[model samples]
Target: MSTHRIRFLAALAGLLLLGAGGNAAAQSTITCESRNGQYQSCSANTSGGVTLSRQLSSQGCWQGDTWGYDRNRVWVTRGCRAEFRVGGASSSNNTGAKVAGALVLGAIVAAAVANNKHNDHDDRYDNDYDNGYGGGYGNGREIRCESTSGRYTTCGYVDRHQHVEIRRQLSNQQCVYGRNWGVDGRQLWVDDGCRAVFVVY
Candidate 1:
């Protein structure tokens, strides 16, 4: 099985345990919290069973929405902060659906990857956001991306996971990587009066 499939199965195992409600007075609990809107995991005996006992954040603690568990730990994301009750009986014989579910998920992931690759070329746009050099990154056309007056501005579309390298610098303001300019989400951003022509592969 692929790594993604294995991870999906392990997380599913924890969701199943939540449904198998056992002891209400389970003597164990642990607090899991998401720090600054980032996902966080906390150690707990989640195999026993898990339930959200109390919420510490204004973000609602909805099961499988803001919080989830695996066999070993409970995770919180999207500013969720909560104490989870653990220590109910671990459910066995629930492996029947795990493999089937993973197969379906693997297919979905593969299809998404294929679709993204097919349309990636057309996704980049040449907007008036920067002086026109052209929007073609791999088509041998260069786009002029610049930050004006030390203000941050988006230049062009570049995938958050895609690598962008400076093909040529147009500014004397030092187009240093990650400081004066960088890719943020699906757009390239420039800051601190940095200007450059970027290429993405």
Candidate 2:
């Protein structure tokens, strides 16, 4: 080949290599850990950046740092857990294992917290339920209903709302309500009169 033609081919090859390197650099894996470092979870192979949130309810409680990943700070509650998300690239290498580890770690942490609370006789932390309804309430609108008599009360749902649902009961009195709660697309009803906080997902 002529010298000019050879130079052109070499430049093309270099460009291709550079492109490949760029792709590789853009790839990244996502991992999650409880604030206390008692639990760690990682996502499948992914590129770019990952967004993580704490598992909602009993799975674990975590709050993400307001800042970006560089300043990532996860505030874990007594029963804290973590979640990971892969971004950019799509690969599931060893993801199942990572996820399983995360779940196991979460269970361990939750159990530890429960045991501690039980020993301490902490009524405030007791009776908390995690319905496995997913992450925080998100941007959904909040609807609240209060009952003073601890009697069954209903918090009717509004229209145009859909998805997962969760309820929180707050009471100043040390009363326990039976598990006679029910939820529909439009409303949530509690059989007892406890201040109910409902979030429609």
TM-score to true structure, per model? 0.34, 0.26
lDDT for each residue of candidate 1 in 144-170, tens digit (9 for 90 to 100): 798888888997775433456788999
Evaluated against the true structure, the overall lDDT of model 2 is 0.43
In the range 61-149, model 2's lDDT, one tens digit per residue, is 32221112322322232234445444454234534444555554455555555656356653321222233222233555455766656
Clash pairs (backbone) in predicted model 1: none
Q: Which stretches of candidate 2 lie over 4 Å from their true place?
A: 1-137, 158-168, 173-180
Q: Evaluate model 1: give its lDDT.
A: 0.67
10 residues in a row with least lDDT, candidate 1: 126-135
State the TM-score for model 1.
Answer: 0.34
What is the lDDT of every predicted structure here? Answer: 0.67, 0.43
Error of 1 at 55 (Å): 0.6
Look at candidate 2 and tell me the lDDT of residue 187: 52
RMSD, every candidate, angstroms: 12.9, 20.3
